[model samples]
Target: MAITRRHLLQGGAVAAMAPALGLNTNVSAIGTAHAQSAPDGLKWRHGVSTFGDIKYPADFKRYDYVNPDAPKGGVVRMFELGTFDNFNLVVDGLKGSLADGVRLISETLTTRSLDEPSTAYGLLAEAAAYPDDFSYVIYRLRAAARWHDGKPVTSDDVIYSFEVMKKNSPMYSTYYQHIVKAEQVGDREIKFTFDGPGNRELPSIAGELPVLPKHWWEGNDPQGRKRDVTATTLEIPLGSGPYRVKEFVASRSVVLERVPDYWGKDVPVSVGKNNFEQIRYEFFRDDTVGREAFKGDQLDWFTERSGKQWSTAYDFPAVSDKRVIKEKFVNSSSGGMQGYAFNLRRPLFADVRLRRAFNFAYDWETSDRLLSNGEYHRDNSYFDGIAEFMATGLPEGAELKILESLRDKVPAELFTTPYKNPVGGNDDAARNNLREATRLLKEAGFETRDRKLVDAAGQPVSVEFLSQAQGDERSILFYKPYLERLGITVNIRTVDSVQYQNRLRSFDFDIVTTVWGQSLSPGNEQRDFFGSESADRPGSRNIPGIKNPAVDALIERIIFAKDRADLVASCKALDRVLLWNAYVVPQFAGGFQRAARWDRFSRPEPLPKYGVSGFPTLWWWDTAKAAKTGGRS
Candidate 1:
């Protein structure tokens, strides 16, 4: 559940869309559906769901997970790993590094509930209406919704925001590709029309659109220069959300002060969130330095990623004295694939056998033991940890039927074999795996010449493991020797975060360790992750350049699925195909979130089922605890 640049830039605007069958069904008996008739024969509801009924009703006081009485007045100092150069989300992937926490300044049409798997409650929009076909969705803005400058948020603002995001951001462009047009259908309502019907998730996807102030962007900046939404700028942009940029020193640090007169403060969805009076983010070169800063009280909270550090590095006086709290929060979410993703764009990785050989060469057992202190689980599926979506013990039932239909497009091995990672805990297992890797390499037109792997064109098979974190280098260096034994020249190239993102944007690496975090409900976003169209896009998340027709077909199945059963079956089928193809050398997954923080905050008991640590969202500053721990109050 580590938030990456992709997750931060995308924001929470892409909530799960409901299936096609549930569109027109009246849910008045279910308490909170709030279904009403629209002029276009569509049904307007208070919320949207993917495959089930919405959790909260129209008159619900607040989310069940939050404490309405929780006091919220303290400064929370957090840390970001790299520098940021852009505050413009519209140009996020195309132009510069997006500043962390910028998403807090804007509000999405519908805000997803942390307790629900795939349901979103109205935030900016009071209600959303869509036809049974789901060809288009119309959102009615809240009368209370206003910009920071006190202007009413109109349909024109929503239309302009969607148009600018789709045109300027490659990520958004791909994410919203199915939506063909957006227009003002009412004074307070904006309609997003799709290319065709039957896409259940379109309504929620459209509802997730982040509304920006149209007049502010069209007007001039304080310096009298016309602002360009497509370009990056340091000038603090206009916002309507709970927080605004209070101060900053470029990339080094940023402070966001809570808007005391925020328009949405009294809204039900905003009742128990945005607790911090002043939220500050201090940027560091990497996590290692950030950990030391946390120990010195430079930051108030830290989420530890390295298992080894979580085990041994927090033996400081503050921790032993109970001034610092270290705990693990259960993560009941999809443990999506995180691995050394092979760049298929490279000619060296074009052959499936070669990619399979690399997987065999990765001694994950020994690497886990050394690097993580045996605190990680080997990832075997694209949808690991989600048993319903994970393909196991060979495909069967609906999953088998789905794969059988794609037999001509997918690998034959997918039907007969159950995908699993290579095991290598002992020397015997290590040698056996290495021998298999060598055999696969030979079959893929590679041969050992003078203690080096050479291809048919007499070129050595050299791969640079591009990385940005020192922790990643530790694992890469450990796996480098095993590949070297196969006569492969492995190079570990560690770069700064800015350079690393640039390389990824341009596809300028042989292999890189990246993560694809999955939600319980997977839909249109899958296209950006693995579809053929995103393979060539400059800033799309299809980082490995996957262009399989079978993968594309499976993604459509998941998007247009009719029910929970169909979605699960389609995801399992897609998982099996991706695993058999070996697009990435499988890595490890942590079942819980490891976090350390100063003991100055308190949260409601029984946290939300999905949000691992509510942190600044559900937790509030405790004056007595802050005094005891010497934390900011």
Candidate 2:
């Protein structure tokens, strides 16, 4: 799945707390449970969750994931996948890829802890509290919080940030849809009231909003021009984060420098993080060029996404001489689906049989072997893993109980058989699958005409597989023959990042290879992924343009889920429904961060459990290692 920071930023806003009611005990009674509860104030704890107790205590020192005294003096050069145009993340949204590490210029009220599943600690806000019903949440800003201009960060800034972003950014608007009002209630406190108290995730969602400096935009640039948050601009605005923009070459590179006297440097949450004194990001049009740059030492680090590349790409002199280090870091986190998504908006892919036929025509096993050296596994479920996100051995227990309500609406076959991808490791296996695909196409009002699949009106079935990466053409080419065998035309169109992103937002592609990042606890974001409302929204993650009532209902259940068991049941039911519909041709997925870097830095003893956020953020420059290898530091 496409695991962008945009996806990760949404993690903390949805509730992943302990269940007030026990598992299996709440599903039958959920129907009668009221959506809203009585109002009550909850004193601020160090962090928040759904069921389990907070990992950090009220007086905890710092997170265990980082080194409190890691020496930080190095220039860590990173690479961006595609080119970027706009530096504005809010207004540009889906139109531009935007500059990498842009979030360094802003701070959210609460930030996600890398090690935890669904928990957040205070950042700008020293304390955050909500009511039992979750009707409203209040945040008290830290007195020491100051903008780069040496001005105090205030409650007014918090309120203004919400109002502006909700109006300008479509993403923020959808994420903050449940929030009804934001106002300054006290000298340093801001209060946010919800549309109603019933939803359990409103408080956490409200905390995730990136607080913008009202004085910066509402006032003027150095030239005395009024600024608008919705307009894309190159002018660097004032920020209160740990770093500020040092220099930038439009669409090519952006460099950031640590603020030597930053106010929040010693804060508990900020300790041992943002260690690099100078961080740089250079842009490349594709991965091939980026890989070559890393090998030549033009770039400092590269993450190998292809299993085939990991197996064979690093046999260089630097690697053999031990000047470059290669390691596979374990990413023991929830995995989302990465597949060839069929656009439901297109009438050609609207039929379930037709979609299923497309899946049967392609051979994942052969593709996995040829393209990835058999290092990856064929992903079957939308939420694929050994975790709760995964659905194992069909629906049972609470999953069956939840799915029973939608028995009349979903596919009948789902009740009798577990979903599995069609097996095709060789020519004969592929032939059998295509024969079945041809039969299904015929049943779905399609027929072969001169060995080309034709519709009811005798028009040929053709689709363009839209992609941004130069590497994706190979994957598309791999499947093209299989599709051609079924009498369907496959057109591979590889565009630059900008045009590709615009195409995605406009719902212009027939088939696109996209990955949806799944969290251990699925919540509000599911609506943006599969809900009918988001199907038409421009920049929404609902890339397949799904508009099913069953999907919409299941997403609601997952969002307002009262307990862990209920969340699993809702997700499994949703996964089964999505799989039964055959929305996408499943692809391969791995649970590791395969990277190669010069041996000049060292990381904490153990990486974070939930993610591998990379070395630029937390790892420090190892002077001893640098001396041993004659590497840049």
The lDDT leader among the candidates is: 1
Q: How much is the lDDT of residue 501 in candidate 2?
A: 76
Candidate 1 global lDDT: 0.82
Residue-level lDDT of model 2, residues 371-405, one tens digit each, is: 99998888888877535656666788888888888
In TM-score terms, which candidate is top? 1
Q: Point out where model 1 deviates above 4 Å.
A: 1-36
After superposition of all CA atoms, the RMSD between model 1 and the true structure is 3.1
Model 1: per-residue Cα lDDT over 23-53, one tens digit each: 3223211223455666496666887766566
TM-score of 2: 0.93
Residue pairs with colliding backbones in model 1 are: 17-201
**Would you give me the overall lDDT of model 2?**
0.77
